[model samples]
Target: MNTPSPARWRPNRYQIVTISLALAIALAFSVFAFQDFRQGQLAFRVFNDEIEVLTTLANIQRHQALMFAQTLAWLDDPAAGKTEIEKQRTFLASQLRVLRPLVANEPEIEQRINNLQAALQEYDRLVESLGESPSPQARATARPQLIELLRRVDEALVKRAYDAQERSFVLDFGNLLRNQERARALLFGVSIAFILLVLFASGLYLRSERNTFNLRQRQIQELQAAVNDRTRALELAAGVSQRIAAIREQSQIVVEVVEQLKQTFNYYHAHIYLFDENRENLLMVGGTGEVGKTLLERGHKIPRGRGLVGRAAETSQPVLVPDTVADPAWLPNPLLPETRAEVAVPIVVGNRVLGVLDVQNNQVGSLSELDVLLISTVADQVGIALENIRSNQVVERLLQEYQQLIETSPAAIGILDAQTGVFVQANPQMLEMFELTPADVGQVGPIMLSPERQPDGRLSQEAAIEHITLALQQGKNTFEWVHHTRSGREFRAEIHLTPAPNREGRPMLNAIITDITARYEAEQQARRRAERETALNRLTQAIQGALSVEEALQITARELGQVLGRKPVLAALQSTLLSYDKEDQ
Candidate 1:
């Protein structure tokens, strides 16, 4: 085996090419590394731009919120605030212009910009149509659109800032980029000198390197295999963690994860399979090359525990087949006949298996446990990326939906000062409940908003304070109280109170007032009906027990009067004659 062959000594295209292009490859790698340094430099620049973007966005949102305040101001004196509103709108537009270029690269943010513009236009039209003096209802309906404008501006900027912080790796490498600058010139000179020296030395060493090539071929190959496997795995793993972290779509993530695995490792095929709604099968969601396309088109899938991919997903672990031909569990596909080695790694998040990442090579014994671990690492990152995207989307959706719910809910909602129980702000339903305007909120006290006495003989102010105190102490409280509108209309309300976000160094409560007047009246009618039945039974028993007619008559009158809540009229045999006094129970 140690003896050298004449054929081995003969110059091959590989060695010749390696010999010829070694210097170029080295220089290119160096230059590429420099480009990476330049990339880090550029990242810093972009980060600075983002900070400015945040500032600009904040100003725009501030103007939007201020415009809302101005609308409230307009309610006070419409004629005086028109020019100021126009001026604020102009400033908002100018700030938006400044923001456009900064986020031009982001289509999502750009779309938000478009929405913000449309909302601004709608707001303008609505405000203009109010026509000098609008009804309280119209003005109330129109005031909150400005908040939507604020949300449009604030939501994107906040998300962008968070994403910017997360995606910016240059912060850690910023110091390293500076160090790279000093070495660049020296590297270029050494590289040139080394290239010239290598040509001369390589010519002499060709004979020696060739003679020893046969002796070292086995060792070189083994080392190269191990090195290549580690390198590809590390690169793929790093790419999953860094390069694709900014990708917000799970579909894109799955595709990129598998495609990069196939490309970087020179695998014959690579694919990602995700669980369907029922999770009984692994469906090919993403893959590489023509085989991947064919499989996806054919709607390829493997049932749980049926194949390597399925087994990986089912167990939430990896399955490796170094030689698929010898493996009894390997699933053969005619489209991927070149698969001689295979590996499948589960894409798991917590206890849930989302999918499997599968890759195959054409050469037998090409895949190994190291490949399994590396692929599994990539799979885990894929899981995290997908989960993060889902969580973020959920949170944003909930936030938007919550605002819409608060804006449009029919239940009377009001924000109150926890200490005094005075409404600081109220929704339309709350305003309608009290027949009060926005301006009346601060002026009205708990007792003024409600009747002086509760149905339970408790002071309205005292009961309100108790409820507010309980909510502040225990996070939430629910109770019933009687309230009177400004028009002296009394209605029964069931108030649910919860602690709200603190404002101005004081606690607050969100009061959800449900009108229970109808329900209360229905229950009271039912109670009276039951009481009348009980009293009739008792009166019958009393009449049966009475020995004298006069005693029976007196007992009948007393029972009738008690039941009717008034004096009973004496009738010979008809005991139904009764009258009710308006002022008496």
Candidate 2:
């Protein structure tokens, strides 16, 4: 009876179970409260992001309006407003690009963005048309359409932005209500368990604080890493850009670009696949490593839309494969067996896709969005460089062909400075005809090619200057002149002077010379022959009408002497000549 009365203050099993249940409920409520807080934080972050997107869209619309106003002003006064309009247009395009990523997940917004893009394109076309011919008719036809398209785009953006704002407000309000309910439940549970769980609550609070500190540290580290990666990407981009800028040849540019990409970015491999003349296949133009050499030897080609590189070129967009083996669009090459990731960016200039820049890595998810952006920029630069190189090559080839033709021409041609009347260039025929070398003719004035006096009784110096001036003013002149060679030999030449366009965009004189020395000699010989014939006829007629042979002989001698410009001796025939001939017979 005394032992039974000893445990009077001890609680029963049901009471202990009730207390345990309350503690459990309190702990569960605390966990739910933390989850709710986390969810609230996430919701707030999402709401803030949505607000930013809406703000950006609003800014884009404002910029579009500004651009429209500028365009109208430009249409009104093209010369005064063109620069401002272009500036506004460029700003609007940049803003639209900024807005593109923000609304990419919203279908309706994306559709509206697409429409805006199309409208902007149409506006650009109309603006270009107006610029080309700033006629009232063209403006009347294009301005209304442009204004309508701009208004539609503006309305679409504004509506989408308003809709997004409304959705964000609804989500925020719902999240707030849910958080308030969760907080009430958490407070009730905590009140029920506080009397029994002070020590437990203290321990849990300490653990949460430690976790928060750890999370903060981890976030700091991640932020630092991101900053470092961004800096590294920027440095790599700048270095590659500088290197690409220094290169002049297309093949050299491709090779340097691929090599830089591989070495700087530490990519597993880098390759450039350019479109062939037919544009049906992408041929490997430049690459790095032994796999590249093997591919080059094998003449590796990717058809349009066949693989990542091909797809990028076909679509003129970038293609990224985080895991090549898992991506259906990726085509594995035996030469690059270790490749786990790959990205192909189209090298485009304006509307032309010159090639595809393909880079790969040995690790999955090695490439980031930053990498894509940097590489895309590099691709654009490479495309521009390749276009410039091709254009320069074409110009050089044409210039070489023109120089060859000039050197091989049969006519004696020389180029003279229009301003100074000095010889700038001479063909081989011209140099040979003048018996002068290039060094001797260099910087020599046109008067150097002629004697002191010309056939037209003008001083050669004054005449050459006058002829150059006339050719420069009238575009062409042709006249015959007497000229002297380097060896002091004078010749009659037909000089043709024509104005020609030079490399400096200024006019130069092209002088073509024709020698008429042989023709002049032939004409003189024919005139002398005619005069001799006339003199002989006159002598014959005088002899026929003469009374005596002496008169006829005298007339004949005088005529022959006059024609020959010298004295002529005549011999008389005697009767003794016939007697000697008869005796011999």
Instruction: Estimate, for each residue in 1-585, the C-alpha lDDT of model 2 and write its tens digit.
Output: 555655557768866876687578667767976887798788777767676666566456555665675566555556665776677678768867877886777777777777777778878876776664488545533444555555466555555664666576557756665665556555544553453344344567556645654564466466557756776786688679768967898878988998999988899999999989999999998889888888889998999888999899989989988889899888888888899999999987544688899999999999878879789868866875776566455445544654676688788888777776667888888888878888966566557768888766889888878877887676568987887787889988888886654536555777878888888889989998998888878888888999975566667666766766443343322243445567779
- Which residues of candidate 1, in runs, are more than 4 Å off? 1-239, 242-250, 263-268, 277-280, 349-352, 384-411, 414-428, 436-470, 478-494, 500-509, 514-585
TM-score, cand. 2 vs. native: 0.49
Task: Give me the candidate number with maximum lDDT.
Answer: 2
Computed on alpha carbons, the lDDT of every model, listed in order, comes to 0.72, 0.73
Please identify model 2 stretches exceeding 4 Å from their true place. 1-232, 417-424, 437-439, 443-445, 453-458, 466-482, 487-509, 516-585
| Model number with the top TM-score | 2
lDDT of 2: 0.73
Per-residue error for 233 in candidate 2, Å, reads: 3.1
lDDT of 1 by residue, 58-159 (tens): 456545655655665675466665877787889888987888888788676677677777778877887887877877545544444444444444455434
